[model samples]
Target: MAKISINLATGSLQQEEIIVGIDLGTTNSLVAYINPEKNPQVINDMGRGILVPSIVHFNEKGDALVGNEAKEFLTTDPENTIFSVKRLLGRSYNDVAAHQDTFSYKVIDDDKESLVKIKAGNRFYTPIELSAEILKELKSRAEHSLKTPVNRAVITVPAYFNDSQRQATRDAGKLAGLDVLRIVNEPTAASLAYGIGLDPSEHKTIAVYDLGGGTFDVSILAIQNGIFEVLATNGNTFLGGDDFDRAIVHYWIESNKLKEAELQANPGLMQQLRLKAEEAKIALTTQNIYNEKLGDIWCSITRITFQELIKVRVQETLDSCKQALKDAKLKTTAIDEVVLVGGSTRTPYVKQQVADFFGRQPHDQINPDEVVALGAAIQADILAGNRSDILLLDVTPLSLGIETMGGLMDVIIPRNAKIPTKAGRQYTTSIDGQVNMKISIFQGERDLVKENRKLAEFDLKGIPAMPAGFPKVDINFLLNADGILTVQAVELRSGVKQEIEITPAYGLTDDVVEKMLVDSITYAKSDVAQRMLIEAKSEGEQLVYTVERFISKNGQVLDEEETKITLVHIEALKAALQDGDKDLILKKADDLNEFTRPFAERLMDLAVSKAMKGKSVD
Candidate 1:
């Protein structure tokens, strides 16, 4: 066999395609790629450092500046500098309504059900659009550093992210002009960076505790045959190192005895104190105490006090660890390794507590903040098919589908299907002469539609009117490699079609998703029974409507006895609909349909005959 030659200068594989990995974080974001040396490396553009503050600012002319450039305006133009945008991604106004006071920038409360929008200067921006701005900057930095046009990337999200949040990330990547190859979970990416699943024959189980600036999650993963599977994930989207900073701020405000009204009135002073608190939090990591001053205000905090303030917060994260273990159906002893991933894990107290809780020393050799990105780069390399020894597969955590009649969830892609998969099912009109079909997409494992989370809704119009159940409406769900979904609805006979990319920009809150899953498990039997009753009730109601409408139009054509018999059947169905009895409702509806079929057919034949009387045979 001929030996492959290597170019040592650029450290890139021969004829290799460069694909970057991105950690589009809440507080900061960065990009990385595998170098020609075959090692994953983060791009440092013009020596600007690896971490880019995920902040954006707009000027009077409405020009946008991102990263470090936009960080300075957080104090000077607090209303225009947007930060912590990742928390708002895939979130509705109501989902973040409780934390509205945290942002200095304007988060417009347009509609509770709609996605949150930020008002910068005179423009309104969705989180997907805003996140794209940050991703674009990361893209530019990668191209500048690597001296190549980088177009494809693997992006990481929290392990507990619902389908909506994951899709929102993919949309942002698309908006940023990057072909997002995969949406990797932070825990899985961190594990990959640590080489936990690199060896195909070695099997391991681990827990990844990720506490970033604005979010925290603990994931239990089982790696077998070089394939990593996420068993369970738990955490809060609003808790992180930023909260530790805030705890210091709260202590200083009390130490100085400063009035809340004063801080509220003076945004500049608040920003100063906030920034100072951040400094103290970092300084106290090594030093016993931290002290500083801002004008007339004194900022002081001891390491002991700092730890005390964050004790409950740290415990909350540990509580999540317990829950993750519980959800995974594994004891802590089952975990063979514990990995740390996130900037906040640098805190000595956090590291010690995590270690104590796990009964072992957690792996922190790699930089917590950069490990996720590095892992993503490695995944990109694998996707490039450079590594034959590794195999990684990701699955959707919840079932996804559309709402059917009687408020039932008709699952198309069930939970645990491998990503980049496609599934479809055929549906039909519920009523005769129905020309339009409404498709409402939902995500959850519940039997009833109302019990699940609604992702998006659209109408498949222009369907040809036909007898009930005669039209075939094929609904297909295409989930790409990135885990983003595109829904297509087609009328097979007429070729009338409608399709929508399901981007849940205003997604449900983290708690709601978790609750939906739990409820699906806890109340599965009741939900199914409720669904059947609702279906029976719906059938009865529809039959009543049809019978009444028929009488209004053709009562004169029928004899008195026929009209009376039809009225009796309609009454029986209506009574069954009210009684809430499934079997009785179905029986009554069927009785009415059977009684009226002959008359309905006779009327149709008569109408055709009348029309034919005035026309010649073709």
Candidate 2:
């Protein structure tokens, strides 16, 4: 008989490859893998801990420090340290501007429909890049513990996350050098962790109540024949375990008659109190009382007092549960299990309230903090072709997006998008007097586009020479049942059009597609940086062409110094282009554009005046 080793976690055959699962959370994150004993375990190397704080610190030299090492900087150097960046992923400036004061870091308010950027010292970073730092930390931990090349993973995200947000998570994974095979929902992963859906013949309907550090959500899941389907999901992104900590602080402030402005003025003191409140919250989970103080500030609370402070917040979760049940159209009696997840579930009040609401004892057998990660490991194992009992659905393993301004990718069709599905969004130019737009299609899971598997590239030409953003370009990607993808772009205003048909996975064996996807992530960071440099070079070449043409035609219109400076700046840009540095190219491009902009505008004015010089009025 031939020997065959089975990974019980994923029900898949164990090969040389290892696919771990990652629980990338708002408050904390953890990595998990199936042990040799077949039980899934969270990695805790050198007792650093299972849960790594999702905090990042930027040193004076701008080197990023992540997780526990960076947590202390939240109070000391809040401006350069960022936490809860999950909230900012895929979010535009307008999406978070109202609460800008909440962040100690400088979240750039560009005041437009563009992705937000964080300015850490002199450098600007997008949320995708910052998130990569955290994932990189987790990846290092996994590699260190396993002593192997841990390149592939299955990461979980909030069920309510939109397509863009999900793409952003995949991108972060890629940037961190992980081939994210799948993006599982947090609730589904939690249910898997508790061993709810492993038995294909067993059927059950469960509600997963996930109350993490910064968010709370309830999901009603129906499990049938090894398939877990989410019937409905509901929650408030603004409510979670962090609110409990804040509740204690709010109660203390009210009872002590402390001024909100005073607390606002003293961020250091406020941060101290917040951490103390968090300690009190955790301590009250097992004990009835917790007491502490910082100088004159009294941070003391009993379990009963803590329950009162969180009463409303707990009720809010229950309400969301009711709504989820209603949306799922299932009665409480129909639920076979209630799974508790998230670090906040340790609170006694939460467990009791959830049990009462469901009329059954919620499952807390698994460690709530680690359940999602364990579930993810199981999913990863399944992806490795280990599991035979589970029925899997076919999906496009990666996201599809078009390269947009600044080398960023805008996902039109997200990863796991059902096959034969078509999705698209409109876009416009980024510069004034722009006449054409280049649409480059890519297949990958990263936000920073590594569109090396570019399906096709073509220009939508003949756009009216108007101000930036004047033209409406609608790019549509249609994938057929046979896996042929036709990417089409049309300028609605001017009817300028172009498109190309390509088989994204054309004639390639399943193994080939899988390898390409893995390689895309393994080199995602370097790929994106190289793509940026190429883009800069292309733009520099285009500028050179345009400037030379303009100077030749209008040499008689310019003064001697005007002509001299323009030629000099143009030469400098050409030199920078040859140096092959993206940043240098962009700087030279901007400088050249700034100097030439007024001249171009002046030319336009002159043409308009010449046309109307002798025309009658009115």
Candidate 3:
């Protein structure tokens, strides 16, 4: 007789390993795995439910609380509770400045171009760290429920996520102690869960419309011979179910004659109203009217009126669908199927609208919320060599990037990304009257390019002479199926272009690639710290230059005391930049920003008033 190990917690035969699938979502997250019965199933640990709210709260002890435990802090301690962190990942301060106020927590904007940071309590955190906490919770739940060690995973991201965002997701998973085997697109995963690509013989062109709590994206996918190729993707990162909640909140405020100032002053009431609005949005889905009240504030809406409020917003998503089709260069008639994903699709109007637009009924057999995770599980099984019929996509063995300001390795195509892919990012010159831009390509995982392997270098010649940050340089990397890389650089404004080809893995053996990967992980902490410091110094230098130039031109606009204070702050930042302390440099830069913001606004107002000096009003 042969003896087999058993998992006491699950009362099942223990496997040697398990590669779980994780949907690290905006509003909620969940983990799934292929069970012993060869079925993809979500883990519901201790009956706590499958969906974990993507929220993290920092307590007085400075410990992080995630998921359901952190949900309550959204009202009681909004400043310490972080939600919708996915929106901030791989985004600069300028990228999300307009929407920063929507987040209750403080988002640090040291420089407009650097990645956004969150300040919860006294400590500053990147979106990657916050997301890691959520991933850790999911990992713990999966391990507990499966009664096995789960160290590897397949994570999903939005279809429109760029290389930086994808890399950020992978780093977050690494921080959570999981070796991310692949980053699958959410729409692609959703299609897999619906069994659309289970059969290699199946050929179809489908559209996946995903509208989550904080994000919306429509992806056009063409499946042929078990390969899922994304033709195009379009959506607004900030437009989603949250906007629907906001619409209801605005209607209530207008209907009840509530003051915006009062709501701003009373956060608890605002949170209550927001939450109630969310409830009403859900209730109106099945009922004709949803009526409720919090204290003296009446929250009321009819299904008809609710739909009317969100009609424009819903139309916006439909327009995105149209744009996606246009980008894919396909007609509505070309679409063989439409898949509805995300919890927002539960709304009757959204489903019907998508169905009508596609000229066919959409697929929603799988739960919209769990579809992506289940699909990820299936993919994980394939990666684990359990499925042979489905083909596993080939991926790049290492990250591919270029050297940006401060010699930072700005990854444009991350490691483990599916091959035969292309991605690009915009860049700008750093000096005045710059005519030529250097493009240095590298392959490795280090934060700085000098430590990575340089693949090629070239210059984008004939750039029109212009001031710093004026030229729009787009660098694109296209990796073909045979492991050949083609890099193209173009000055978008002038159409001055340059292209080069290189073999990314030429002369590199498996051991060398493996060593590079190991070295990157070993130095991940120090590399990130060094990269952040360099970015801080670069930001400080840019700020100093901008402030000095402003002072030189607009000295007369400032009073003596104002000018004196501004100069002092500028000098402080310069001094901090001279030192190597990243935090101090950021602190001084922030001080300068705070001091100059009011006068900056005043100067703009004066200019506007002068321009309108005898003009008639609209």
Once fitted onto the true fold, the runs of candidate 1 whose alpha carbons sit more than 4 angstroms away are 1-15, 108-112, 259-265, 392-618
Candidate lDDT values, in order: 0.81, 0.81, 0.87
Can you give the TM-score per candidate against the true fold?
A: 0.65, 0.77, 0.83
Model 3 global lDDT (CA atoms, 0 to 1): 0.87
Assess candidate 2 and give its TM-score to the true structure. Answer: 0.77
Clashing residue pair totals per candidate (backbone < 3 A): 3, 7, 0
- Candidate 2 off by > 4 Å: 1-15, 201-204, 253-268, 292-298, 326-334, 397-423, 429-482, 486-505, 509-522, 531-618
**lDDT, candidate 3, 278-389, per-residue tens:** 9998897789999887899889899889889999999999999999999999999999999999999988999999999999999988889999999999988877768868
Better of 1 and 3 by TM-score: 3
Candidate topping lDDT: 3
lDDT of 1 by residue, 1-618 (tens): 212222221112233569899999998999999998999998999999999999989899878899999999988899999998888887877988899998998775533444576777756567877898899899999999888877678899887776667766765776676656677888888988988888889888899999988889899999888767889999998899989988988888888899989998998887787889888988987899897888888888888888999999999999999999999999988999999988999899999999999999999999998999999999889876688676545656567899988788877775545667888877888788999899999987677888778889999999998987689989999987666799999999999999898753244554554455445545744664576577557656766876787799788678999899989988888887888876577566656766777886888777788778985422
Candidate 2 residue-wise lDDT, 1-618, digit = tens: 223343322223345678899999889999999998878999997889999999999999999999988998888898999998999998988888887887889886533465676778766677888999999999999889889878778999988887668877887887888767788899889988888888888899999999998889899999898777889999987898888988898887887788989988988878878888988888888899897877887777899989888999999999999999999998999999999998899999999999999999998989999999999999887777767777665556556778976576677876555567787778887566889788888875444565435667888888888766678888888877666788989889888888889887645444544554555665687865665576567667767777787899877667899999999999999999989876677667667877887786888777778778975322
Where model 3 places Cα greater than 4 Å from the true spot, the runs are 1-16, 60-62, 232-239, 242-333, 356-359, 433-438, 458-465, 491-500, 598-618
The clash number for model 3 is 0
